[model samples]
Target chain A: MDKLNEILLNYADVDEIPDSASFRKDLGLSSFDTACLITEIRTVMGISLEPADFIKCKTVGALKDYLNTK
Target chain B: MIEKILPDGSKVTAFPISIPQQFMFFMSAQYGAKYPVNNIGLCCFIHGGADLEILRDALYEAISRCDTMRLRFTPDEKYKILQYITPETEMNIDIIDMSDIPLEEAKLKLQSISREDIPTYNCEIHKISLIRFKGNTDGIFMRLHHFAMDAYSTGVFLRDASEIYLHKTKGTAYPKPMRPYLPVLLQELQYINSPQQTEDKDYWFRSLSEADEPVFTDYMLDNRLTQQQKKNPSQRFADIHSGSPEAGTLIFSMSEDESKRILSVCEEKQLSVCAFLSMGLRTALSVFNNNETDVSFKMIVNRRGTVAEKKSGGIRINYFPMRSIIPGDMKFADAVNEISLIQNDIYGHCSLSFWDMLIERHKSMPSDAKPDSTYDSIGLSYQPPTEHIQLGSSPDEVIWFNNGASMIPLYLTIKHRTTDGGFDFIFEYRKDPDPVYDLNIFFTKLRGALLAGAEDPDITAHVLLKQLKITDEERKGKNNG
Candidate 1:
């Protein structure tokens, strides 16, 4: 599994995971959880990310795309 | 009835203390009389082109406006029963000239002054003093026994004082007077004795009967890190003197933008800021203690606006134990939902007093089943937004210096300033000769967890445990070994 997917699976139901699934709406993730995800991505991907950056990526696909850019 | 008429023609009312104040009085008596347990001090710096005389008059006006400001507690014939007396006389405001002293010295003097304990045997319930520095800054100091007022009352007093000062200085009309606590206390007393209160007490009794014993003991005992310290020679030597603990406070703040983001995230998740912080705290404790899932701590809730409490303030707060069992395999979102539900249930019956809950628990459960008062040594409190009082057009900057002893082993107070929308986290902990945990690391981890949680709402507790390299089985195995 990709790093993002692995992190998401720990928090969200596997059945709920989809490329277009919204982290906030579909996954029911809190801001704190989102923050932890960003921190994990920073550590795993070796890049700095801000809250605004993650906040802009509403879906799993969007976040994945953003991570690729980094 | 009128206690006494002041020379200034203000009427004084004598009334019985509320149930909450009675609880504090009893607790103080039970704990020893050498030190006041819940005395709180608030000191703030005033920077503006303001005169000392005008500020003094404003302080006097504030005292006259709020009965709590003039409130005094006298012991009645009943043990630990205090009668609330609103003396009509003008409250003395001591003005000291620190104009020649250096700013650092002035601050040290203020700190020393704030730490001074109130003479419980005295007739006065509170004190207000001021210090004038050489620079444009002046200081307003207030020290009050918990029986006299609470944290909310401090805001009310400041707002009133500032309004009175503005009216005196700029000829602005003072806001309409708020109803005093005397009549409110009387009403509260009647309500507490009513059938509704009895029902609430029953609800609390049932809740306590079903509540689990605090899981903190388990975490403290099972954590490998704390256990490893037992082998250290210095730590073993210092443990002998750990009984007598000195209390210290650590204050931290987050910028406006950070606070706003966290708040917005909380709103998005349908969780209150208090709930979010509580979760962060639980997660931090869990991770710190080998990913222990069962987290328990008492959360102090303000009951001022609640039905059982008096709308006018004089110690309307209660501590309720918040217990959450976040399974190591549980998703973070699921844990948040579970906590939110539990919080809702607890808040529904929050009007029940902590003392009453203790009494009920002791009475309802067998000796072996009854939980001890070990849970009382840690608490979390969140201060709601209050009116901001500015000294000048630039807006008044007030920095709170807490000098009182910690009520618990660890008490965390989260306050959001209305003036700047910033967050202040004050962690007051007992400073023992042999500390079990490093508070600096604890605070840093908690803050990091909160910030990380806010940044990535999709991260599960399991993932967090993995990322932080925490393994519960390994920790437990070490403990067993």
Candidate 2:
């Protein structure tokens, strides 16, 4: 699993997170969960992203791509 | 701070208290230990069908796994608070079935169960129970000392417990373990003397020092403060403060649609809901005091910058003054944007102890001057929506019990309702007056201003005051029409 999925796994009950799964819709993450995810990404993945930017990413695939580009 | 072998063959190790913990002690001393100033009473009813046996096992598993559940507060001759983790086996869970009683009576029974406080100096940290309510649903009543857990951590504990319960019920694998608590504690201790601490101290000192002493901005529509001041000449201090720490709560829940409207506006502007709410509050404060441009209030900054701290359970709150001297001509949008910027700046330096800095500032005050407590009297804490556990049809049905005591005069906490992501404004006020009618009026004004500002960001705050000044009868007539 990627670092993103690894972090998501900690919060979500799912064993795996598909890149297509959107945070709020599919994964059932709350705004607070997304906020915590942003904090984790900053620490674990060394990515600096605001909550707004994260919200802009509609799905996990988009976030992964955004991080990869960064 | 020490390690010793008890005569009973139990080993005990002690850790120094954090700044938040120190503040809890300070407040408790002022409130008198009988009040249990740190106790937080929370009673939540779960709607879904949860097997009692399975839930009990899950509670055991969660307690065994989460180090936060093991924390105990014990003070020795050396320190006022020395915390240590107890064995998970030491936890005692109560299962109460109040189904036999009427709903109202059962609620009272549950409230009584949730209202118990941890002894002031003892290590008996919390009380957890599984209650069967009148509707055949299970309720979790928790009496947690603020020292061991905060609002965020309460969410974490419930989330984890639900996860464990699901894993057991569905025959799936147990979820990922929470980060260890000791490392987080040690990291906080290191921060006390670090470079970041120095920077934070300097920033806060500069921030508070720049603002002039703020006037009391009463949220009550009745102008309770003004009336009380006029009635008692010498008790003018009561106008700006609450003489007693005993608190009563007034909860005002906003509709899901209204909440969504605010959330949409926040997203469109790329603003945190907290900032928007802060601006709304600051605008109302200004409006209440003849459009007082210089307004300040204590804003809660939870130092959960790192994932470890965010995931772990403990109190790491830094309540500092969010001083805003808004220009009379500034647009509501611009004001909110400025508030958000200040929040971001302060959040960056949140690890420092605001309480310590506050004490230091007090020491610098003149001998005869009473320490101005205006900023703290009116405060706001916006809670981020953490992972939620469902016990009912809609998780928003959860009911919170009062601790019967509070440390502040006026505190407003904005929480997201889990059912539909709506807003729950819980106001904890001093025990003296029942501010329900005025509190409702205050929210109506704040909500109107917020909605109006969101609709037209360019609207100046001076214009927003019109909403605040709207007569209750007129507002009702407008609603009727």
> Number of the top candidate by lDDT?
2
List the per-model TM-score of the A chain. Answer: 0.83, 0.92
* lDDT, candidate 1, B1-481, per-residue tens: 4254344554444456676777777666654544456577766677653677889888887777777766665544543344545557456888888889887887777666666767664367678888787677787877777887888777777887888898888898776565567666776677766886788788877776676543442223244324535664222101121233346777778788888878787767655566778887787677666676767777787755321222255777778878788776666556666776676566656666677776775664434333443433358888755657777556566655555455456778888765686888887766653223344455555677777777887778877766654345534544554
* Interface root mean square deviation per prediction: 14.5, 5.1
lDDT of 2: 0.72
Give each prediction's root-mean-square deviation over alpha carbons. Answer: 13.4, 5.0
List model 2 lDDT by residue over B265-299, tens digit each: 87676666788999988877766566778777788
Error of 1 at B382 (Å): 0.5
DockQ of all candidate complexes: 0.02, 0.14
**Which residue segments of model 2 deviate by more than 4 Å?**
A1-70, B5-9, B120-123, B211-213, B221-239, B360-368, B391-396, B470-481
> Relative to the unseen true structure, what is the C-alpha lDDT of residue A68 in candidate 2, on a scale of 0 to 100?
78
The TM-score obtained for chain B of candidate 1 when compared with the true chain B: 0.83
Q: How well does candidate 2 score on lDDT at residue B22? A: 78
